[model samples]
Target: MTGSGTPPTTIPGSDARSNGLPEAAPNPGQRVLVAGGGGYIGCILTRCLLDRGYRVRVLDRLYWGEEVLGHVIDEIELVQADVRDFPGSALEDVDAVINLSGLSNDPTAEYSPEANWQMNAVATENMADACVARGIDRFVFASSCSLYDGLPAGMHDEPPQSSRAAPTPPPSTTASSTCSRWRAIPSARCRCATAPCTAGRRACATTSW
Candidate 1:
């Protein structure tokens, strides 16, 4: 969608290191398809990408409204669609993909487990498959530290030894864990970033495979 406004000159949390991307950054101007690019985290992330000179294509259902991206509406390509039912054509001309689409919080997941699974797990798998089919090599899936929620409070960043002993986790945690397993895809260089709670701008520990 095109808008008349200019892109915002400054975004509060636009620092590169704090965005949780890997040390090896993509070259500027590569088109990055950001699924769920209208949500809270996605809005900030889309802006950062634009500021860094990457062309962004946002594919979002806009459940929270498109106003979040109002400033940059004209600066990038915006595709309004659900990630679960995303069209194959949407991936055309995209150099890479950053999947941020999912039921983000526990309350939303608890309210509807089926939708959560579809959005977080099934959609992620489908997106990865789509990327592979199109020969897109770099796929970044936004996972969560919630997978370790079953562990002790201070044990989130620790190894998963304790997490294995935890009881069956909720849908949100399971979905995030499922997405993390995408690193096993042989044809793609997948990176899963275990995102921490967002306060302001912060760095996340990423495990690449």
Candidate 2:
């Protein structure tokens, strides 16, 4: 069982030939670019990725303080940039992209709906497009459980209907959009996994072409 306490379950549709997420271990030294690496989830993921022997680069606007990433500062490269304006040059040579950029939590989204849509929705699609354009095959989108809101306790295990996509809440339009983009990519392999939610835990879906 993972730290989440739920016995681990294989996320539907995961394929090792695609994004490499399901691989027992990713090859050492493969470079992965993490957008929004300054945030809480990103900070934790960055360290873990490093420990697994992958090279990491972070692109963030630093909406939060940088102190969380300080411990790994020298080990990884940091690019101060927003997901909306991320440069293609940065994607050069990157083997994969992990997108964590977005308006986190309901309060922040409520405070600025337009900004939330732009950052969470618009920018997420942009990242997928950019990755495709640059020939980056792997993408992992860190999405929130806000999508699962109102789901009945037992219904959480229910499969998506017809659409073949995960059921998401209205608040997570961004995640839905990102999943749409992955679906549009015919060569991409996609998987939706429900991670155990802790006090502030986040979950992600992985895709690859």
Candidate 3:
């Protein structure tokens, strides 16, 4: 899951901001901060932002090799900082924050539950607080729809509830528990999606398979 944030500015050729997200290009020169911008999804998103004329700054620990960004490393302002230890000052002059920093998968989270909690839950909360304190209101929290696998087969389309509306097939794991909590954070903007993408993942899967 990867979260992206942008101020209320209109993008060219789209009415994307009608959903409380600020327009992506109401005006040019808006600066965006991509936390964990070196990861798989972050790398692609950063490239898109640059192509769209936004100034991008990426903060990533680069646990993955830097090769994903080799072509664009020179094009972006890269900062090597762990999400848990990042400072608010880094967000200065930033118009929005997209938090993609966290353990990327279930095996990693299951292996190191403590670190997972800190990175996925604790660090996320800290980042949201810092963004709010710094007056950066646009926060997009990317969350997995895999958690929805827990839902009953027939209830997938039900209106979302503040609590679990159906019995889950399996007991919750550390990641799901923490994600449920993160979903409830009043300060952060969470996009509760069930894919690795917004719309394209499912479309591509159906077409390819």
- Evaluate all candidate structures by whole-model CA lDDT and list the values in order: 0.69, 0.66, 0.61
Q: What is the overall TM-score of model 3 with all chains considered together?
A: 0.64
The top-ranked prediction according to lDDT is 1
TM-score result, candidate 1: 0.73
Say which prediction, candidate 2 or candidate 3, comes out ahead on lDDT: 2
Query: Looking at model 1, which ten-residue stretch has the lowest summed lDDT?
Result: 199-208
**Candidate 1 lDDT, 1-209, residue by residue in tens:** 33569664664335534555555545887899999889878888889788778899999999988888998999989999998898888898988788888877666766887887788878888887787778886677665434444455442333343345434454445544654576665655554444334311122434211
Model 2 over residues 1-209: C-alpha lDDT tens digits? Answer: 35676777776435444333544454679998888888878898789789878899999998776787898999998998877787777787898887777777767776987777777777877777777776676776655444544454443332322232433333345565666557676876442222323111223222311
Best first by lDDT, ranked: 1, 2, 3
Error of 1 at 167 (Å): 7.5
lDDT-better candidate, 1 vs 3: 1
Most accurate candidate by TM-score: 1
Candidate 3 per-residue C-alpha lDDT over 1-209 given as tens digits, one digit per residue, 9 for 90 to 100: 23467456654424433332343545347788888889878899889778767888999998887888887898888888898898776788988677677766656766876777687767877776676677665565554332343344443332222244433321123333443455587754432222224222222222110
